[model samples]
Target: MPKTIIPFGPQHPVLPEPLHFSLTVEDEIVQEAIPGFGYVHRGLEKLCEIKDIHKMIQVVERVCGICSKIHALCYCEGIEQMMGVEVPPRAKYLRTIWSELHRMHSHLLWLGLFADSFGFESLFYHFWRIREKILDINEKTAGNRIIVSVNILGGVKRDLSTEDQKWILAELKEIENKLEEVKDTLFKDYTISKRTKGKGILSAEEALYLGAVGPVLRASGVAQDCRQLQYAAFSELDFEPVIAQEGDSFARMQVRYFELFQSIDLIRQALSKIPEGPISVKVKGYPEGENVFRVEQPRGEVFYYFKANGSKFLDRLRIRTPTFANVPALAKMLTGIELADVPVVILSIDPCISCTER
Candidate 1:
């Protein structure tokens, strides 16, 4: 078979992010992949330099809509550390509730996309219909569905009333039941298995060597989870990372499904035990230092660095998203797989290009 190189990104239909990869293919088998980026680069760090701390929170939230609150939480954690402020226990638990809520929605959203990738239109639509519940809860609780600006300097910008908590829990329970139903279908569906099982396989060692994280690593039989670090109220809760040994597109899907259920459990636990108190503290003094913070996003670990010089604006701000780290692993994993599986493999990372770029 004569080799033919086809560019597979930067604005391609298969890739949600603006990534460019030249795939050298012969009869559908990808012989080689050359990856390139730099598209959608917006100099977010420069914006941090000009935007004040309050304004910059919105900027950071824009880093990724799927993991927006996690961005705010991580950025706030770094600032809180620098300021020597311990967030209220109640606030910590509430933050976890919000974070896990986002995670559940995000993972479910990815599941729908993956289902669509395999031409399962009914599954995709069902998943989206289920996801709207979480979005409704987000809007009712956080006052915004997508870009929720709930996190502030010392705590959250919003509060939950007793009635609100009750309503939220009821909604969450509905979500959990529906998700369980979906999970069962995904696990046993013949077509889903046919399309995903044994496709886009990544060896355990190869995954670790390629610096894979999140579901990609979990699907490869790795048990490592950043959430175990328990940076926030996670320490106060009980949860485990989801994993699978198949290391194929199927395993990736399995990990996501398990994680969605786990997130529901986490939210329930948080709501049950959440204490009542103020959500924020007063940050009177200007930050005069540098710091780094990280959080477990739905995709994976996200890191943000900030430098301040006792001014209204930060001297610098930088973010390293999970997608940036996962891209290399994607390239390595795609090397020997048939081109037909590329979309499933790509969706497995749940790639958030906006997050990676900003």
Candidate 2:
């Protein structure tokens, strides 16, 4: 069979971010894939030199809107580590709540986008509509929707009021109900399973060796999660990473779909046990050392490194997003699959190139 070179992404409508992949196919099976970057460069690295450590929290959050809080959290944690600041117990729990809330909405958003990509219009609309509740709750709590910017150097910038706590719990319960309905629909609906099941296969070894993390790694039967580090309140909450053994596209989707419910459950648990106290701590002296930290973002593990020189401005700042680590795995998975299935496979990795390239 003759080989044909086909390009996908960086400008396609189905993709939420710019990621270009050149696939080599023969007789409808992907033979090889060459992925490239440097398309949407924003000079984010250089900006670290100019922006003060405090001011750059907003900049870090903008690395990706869907996981902005996690990004900010990662940045703050790294800085906190360097400064040797121990955040209050209450602040850690609040971080967990917001992080899980982020995971819930992000998964739902991805579910809608995945459905829309396959022409499942009704499923897409319904999922997105259900996601608005989480967004509304976030706006009510943090005064913003996408980039909540609620993370600070020592702890968090926002607090949940008594009334807000009641409302949030009520909202989470409602979202859980909706997720149950959606879960039933997903499992019963043949169209969705038929399109998604057994589409992309990545074995457990390949996932581990290629640096896959979060749902993608979990889907491949590895329970690897940075959350086990217990950097946040996750240590206090009884914890177990979700996993699926099939290692197929459907498994990936199912892992995320089920995690939505788990996140809802987690939020409720956090609220019930949460302690009342100050949401943030004051940081006066400048950090004088460098530290590295990792956090579980909506998609996967995100890395943040910060260096301070006893001044307000950062001496250096850096990040490594999950998408970058997953790219090599994506190339391996795309091989031997039909060209048409490329989009679903890409979505399965949940690539956030904007964050990756930043």
Best by lDDT: 2
Q: What is the lDDT of residue 26 in candidate 2?
A: 95
Q: Give candidate 1's whole-model lDDT.
A: 0.84
Instruction: Name the candidate that leads on TM-score.
Output: 2
Question: How close to the true structure is residue 264 of candidate 1, measured as C-alpha lDDT?
Answer: 79
TM-score of each: 0.96, 0.97
Model 1 per-residue lDDT tens digits across residues 1-358: 8999988878976566687889999999998988777897787878876778888888888888888989888988888887788888888988998998898889888989888887888998999999899899889989989787898888887888889888988887787788777777888989888878887788899888888778888889999788898877999899878889989888888888888879878888888889878888888776879898877888888877878898878888888898887888888878888898887777777788887777
Supply every candidate's count of residue pairs whose N, Cα or C atoms clash at under 3 angstroms.
0, 0
CA deviation > 4 Å runs, candidate 2: none
Off by over 4 Å in 1: none
What's the lDDT for candidate 2?
0.86
